[model samples]
Target: MAARDYGQYSGITRAMELVGERWALLIVRDLLVGPRRYGELGAGLPRIPSNILAARLKELQAAGIIRRAPRSRVIVYELTPYGRELEPVVLALGAWGFKALDEPREEQIITPDSMTMDLRTAFRPLVAAGLPATAYAARFGVAELLIRVEGGELDVSRGDGEADLAFAAGPDIRRLISGQLAPERAISTGVVEVLRGRGELLTRFASTFHIAA
Candidate 1:
């Protein structure tokens, strides 16, 4: 069968027009976290050329996925409420990619803030399973973390502890979650450290959440 041109159908053509080219997804990913200036976006994604970045930004704006915010007579790109809805898609795609990659030899260091966010998803199950009769939690990397529950409300805090499960990363949050950080060497010297829960209580809840492999 003769193959049709990708630039033909309106829907297919439009999808291609928006995200078909390289760097488009990266642009979307950058915006997923929060609003960022052009320079910040460019710096975060070094692989994209300036000219291409400008063009793609324009296309995203035209597609109503992003918009400019005014600040001291300057404009910065930010997601529109409609565009902000894509956060789930961006995160889900990243999660899927992480699982598809090879397992690393090193412990993926999950940071304090990122750990809080990760727990937002993973910790929910623990709460649903049954909140401990007392304050139940995990500690890692000289950091103490507690996600306490009572009366259907959630409380989270971090401090000092003989961390039963310590998590640290050799790379940034984006790299780890995206699975670009190599597994074999990443865990070799322990640049990124992960000290999992020790006792049986922590062990039972270990599968509660993960930063993939």
Candidate 2:
């Protein structure tokens, strides 16, 4: 498909000319988290047609927003530094769109990238202050993330392994982080779990992330 030239005078229009196509910004959103193989991208966006995804990747690469790089033995799609500058734009848009999130219907699905990004946006250093270093394994059925918080800092990485705490990622995670749900209640209900001596880590984890939405 030929790129749409929305005239060069209007910056927003020109910007849209680069990312206005359906699923274009979403592709950017996924790449913001980290590099992904074609299959990983497909798993994150189940509804996007494979052909359309291919086309968008080619378009983005041409736009200098993303690049193909060889990682290990596979080629992975990653955002350029210029592309990564879109982080605030995407996150601000997400924060603005939060109010529009209606109650979940039967058809709604939350992608792992979205979940991880939400965690990124919701992290609050003040809340994490004075907390001991801790590691958590967050499992969300199809995805697993390792989150480490220490010295009022948070780091999240792909893959799951041993950690101070292990918890299932669900609707309750948001609620817990938001203080809408009590930590004990979440644990009692099996919505969260922790190692034998690491129960306090769960509460600390919940406190460290605050999602106002």
Q: lDDT of each prediction vs. the true structure?
A: 0.56, 0.80
Which has the greatest TM-score?
2
lDDT of 2 by residue, 26-109 (tens): 999999989999999998999999999999999988888999999999999999998998899988787666545555666667
Best of the candidates, lDDT: 2
* Location of the lowest summed lDDT over 10 successive residues in candidate 1: 198-207
- What stretches of model 2 exceed 4 Å from their correct place? 1-8, 193-197
lDDT of 2 at 68: 97
Instruction: Tell me the tens digit of each residue's lDDT in model 1 across 20-131.
Output: 6777766776676557799888876766799988988887888788999986777788888877776676566655665554543465444443344444434334443564
CA shift of 119, model 2, Å: 1.0
